[model samples]
Structure formats: structure tokens, C-alpha cells
Target: MSVSLVLTVMREAVIRILVVSGPIVIVAMVVGLVISIFQATTQIQEQTLSFVPKLVAIFVTLILAGNFMITTLKEFTEYIFRLISGM
Candidate 1:
């Protein structure tokens, strides 16, 4: 493909990836921030305290958004395939 076409595809791919993972990442970041605040206040420095909650929140986010993520990826893949076929 031409340079512009390649760049366009790459840009779209990045956007798709960001859209798909944004929710999970946002949830994990919020959970981590809250845990850090709690740790600071309580002097509870248990490592797992921070890790477990973020992990669980990310997992739950994935479960909730799984279908949307899959659909996004599928559409991106189809778009790429169509571009290839057109070339």
C-alpha cells in the first residue's frame, strides 16, 4: 500500500486498540490510586493490597467490556482485510 494508506491503517489500529483497552486501563488506574491513598492513610504497606484490587478491577472491566472489545477488534481486522483485498 501507499505511504498514506499505511499511515492511515496504523492510525486506525492504534485508535482501535486505545478504545478497546481504555476502560480497563482507566479502571485499573482509579483502583490503584484509591488503594494508594488508603495505604497512605492507614500505613498498611502490604503489596498485595494494591495488586489484588487493581487486578480484580481490571478483570471485572474486561468481563464487562469483553464483547465491545471483541467487536472493535473484529471490525478493525475486517477493515484491514478489505484494504488488502482492494490493493
Candidate 2:
């Protein structure tokens, strides 16, 4: 591929990755922040306090958004296959 085409593919791949990951990341951040605040207020300081909630939130996010994520990745894969076929 030409430099411009390669760059375009890279950019698209990054954007797609971010799009797929954004919800889980945001959920994890929000859960972590809330857990931190709770710890600050209550002084729990338990190591698992933040980890468990964030993990659960991320899992739930993935479950809720799995279809969208899969569809997006499928589209990207199809685009890549098309590019390969053209090449």
C-alpha cells in the first residue's frame, strides 16, 4: 500500500479500537472514581474494593455493548478483506 493508504488504515484501526473500547473504559473509570470517593469518605482502603467494582462494571459494559463492538470489528475486518482482495 502507498504511504497515504497505510496511514489511512492505521488511523481507521485506531479509531475503531477506541470506539470499541470507549464504553468499557469509561465505565471502569467511573466505577473506579466512585469507589475511590467511597473509600475517601469511609476509609475502607480495601484493595479489592476498587478492583471488583471496576471489573464488574467493565464486564457489564462489554455484555451490553458486545453486539455493537462485534459489528464494528466485523465491518473493519470486511474492509481489510476487501483491501486485500483489491491488492
Candidate 3:
């Protein structure tokens, strides 16, 4: 493949990764920030307190977005394969 084609594929792969991961990362960040605020206010610095909620929130996000993420990945994979075949 040409350098331009390789770069295009890489760029598309990166964009797809960002699209797939953005929601879960954003939700976890927000949940973690809120939990930090609550911990600061209430002074309940339990270790599991931080871990559990973020984990649960991420899991929930994955559950809710799972189909969308899968569909996106499938499309990306198909596009990549087609690009390869075309080359």
C-alpha cells in the first residue's frame, strides 16, 4: 500500500477507537469526579467507595452502549477490509 493509504487507514482506525471509547471514558470521568466531591464533603474515604461506583458506572455504560459500540467496530472492520481488498 502507498504511504497515503496507510496513513488514511491509521487515521480512520484512531477515529473509530476514539468514537467507541469516548462515552465510557467520559461517563467514568464524570462519575469519578462526583464521587471525589462526595468523598471530600462527607470525609468517607473508603477505597472500595471509589472503585465500586466507577466500575459500576463503566459497566452500565458498556451495557447501554454495547450494541452501538459493536456496530461501530463491525463497520470499521468492514471498511478496513474493503480498503485492503481494494489495494
Candidate 4:
């Protein structure tokens, strides 16, 4: 593939990854931030308090968004395969 074509594919791949991951990451971040605030207020420094909620939030986010993520990745894979076949 030419340089521009390669770059385009790489760019699309990166964007797809970010789009797929963004929701879970955001959920984790929000949960972490809320836990941090709670810790600050209550002085409850239990490690699992922070870890468990964030984990659960991320899991729930994945459960909710899993189909969208899979569809996005499938589309990107198909696009790449088409590009390869065209070459």
C-alpha cells in the first residue's frame, strides 16, 4: 500500500480503538473519581473500596456497550480486509 493509504488505515484503526474503548474508560474514570471524593470526605482508605466499584462500573459499561464495540471492531476488520484484497 502507498504511504497515504497506510496512514489512512492506521488513523482509522486508532480511531476505532478509541471509540470502542472510550465508554468503559469513561465509566472507570468517573467511578474512580467518585470513590476518591468519598475517600477524601470519609477518610476511608480501603483499597478495595476504590478498586471494586471501578471494576464493576467498567464491567457494567462493557456489558451495556459490548455489542456496539464488537460491531465497530468488525467493521474495521472488514475494511482492512477489503483494503488488503484491493491491493
Q: Whole-model lDDT for model 4 versus the true structure?
A: 0.93
- CA shift of 6, model 2, Å: 0.5
State how far residue 44 of model 1 sits from its true place (Å): 0.4
Enumerate residue pairs that collide in model 3. Answer: none
User: What are the per-model C-alpha RMSD values against the true structure?
Assistant: 0.7, 0.7, 0.9, 0.5
lDDT of 4 at 55: 88
Lowest lDDT 10-mer window, candidate 3? 78-87
Which residue pairs in model 4 clash with each other? none
Name the runs in model 1 displaced over 4 angstroms. none
Q: All candidates' lDDT scores? A: 0.93, 0.94, 0.94, 0.93
Return the TM-score for candidate 1, rounded to 2 decimals.
0.96
TM-score of 3: 0.94
Residues 1-87 of candidate 4 have per-residue lDDT tens digits of: 699998998999889989998999889889999999999999999999999999889888988999999999999999988988998
Separately for all candidates shown, the number of backbone clashes (residues 3 or more apart, or on different chains) is: 0, 0, 0, 0
Q: How do all the candidates rank in terms of TM-score, highest first?
A: 4, 2, 1, 3
lDDT of 3 by residue, 25-63 (tens): 999999999999999999999999999999999999999
Report how far residue 86 has shifted in candidate 3, in Å. Answer: 1.9
Cα-based TM-score, every candidate: 0.96, 0.96, 0.94, 0.98
